[model samples]
Target: MKIYTKKGDSGETSLFGGTRVPKSNERIEAYGTVDELNSFIGLAASYELSESGTKYLRKVQELLFTLGADLATPPSSQTRIDRISADDVSFLEDAIDTLEENLESLKNFVLPGGSQPGATLHIARTICRRAERATVKCANVDDISDNCIKFLNRLSDFLFVIARYENKHAGVREETWKGKQ
Candidate 1:
């Protein structure tokens, strides 16, 4: 199949159910941001410090792809195939819990840099938030599952914990914002 469909040249694109909307539609923006987050997750995964981290990141990447598919489909015609399961969100929660068990409890705001991999994870976390926001906006107009938003919210938390875990593993000290102290 040719990569260029030539159908979108007129500034419109088709949703999963064959519904055509403008290329600038909110649904397009929502899924596009999810796709962007997936790429950042791939970059972060490339620099993971441990086998477990790599595996978890791979799972997160797959979930983000599922989210992208969910967002790309028209809500009225969306199917089970496009929905992300609760299990996917629970997996992220489990990983976050496992990583947090080893880290010191947070008492202050964190500066978002550390080892190279940690910094990349932080970048991915921010992108995840943007994707979530975009998805929320789309949901306001379309029929999006609450679980979808919940998954994105938890995924951002998971990325933050993973970044801290990576920094701790790398012996990189987290620079706390001491403010006027």
Candidate 2:
């Protein structure tokens, strides 16, 4: 299939149900940011210190693709394939719980830096927040699944924990935010 169909040349694109909307549509913005976050997650995964970290990141990337599919469909015409179910959010929560089990309790805010993978995970986490915010904005005008937003929220938290985990495993000390201490 040709990559350029010239269909979106007029600044409009089709949703999953063949409904066309402007490229600047909120749905597009939300899914686009999700795509961006997925890329950053891939980059972060490339530098992960543990096999489990890479595995989790790959799963998150897959979930982002699912979210993009969900956002790409008009609610009026959406089907099961376009639905990001609560099970998706539960998956993220489970992953978060597992990762948190291996992490130390947070005593204070952490400075975002340490090993290269840790820093990249921090960047990915911030991008995940942006994606989540964009999704929330889309939800204001559309029938977005609450699970989608919940998954993103938990995924960001998972990224933060994975960053600290990577740092700890790599023998990199986490820099705590000490307000002038």
CA lDDT, every prediction? 0.86, 0.85
Q: What is candidate 1's TM-score against the reference?
A: 0.94
As a TM-score, model 2 comes out at 0.94
lDDT of 2 by residue, 62-107 (tens): 8888889888876667455746778877887788788788888988
TM-score per candidate, chains pooled: 0.94, 0.94
Clashing residue pairs, backbone N/CA/C < 3 A, model 1: none
Q: Specify the poorest-scoring 10-residue window by lDDT in model 2.
A: 74-83
Highest lDDT model number: 1
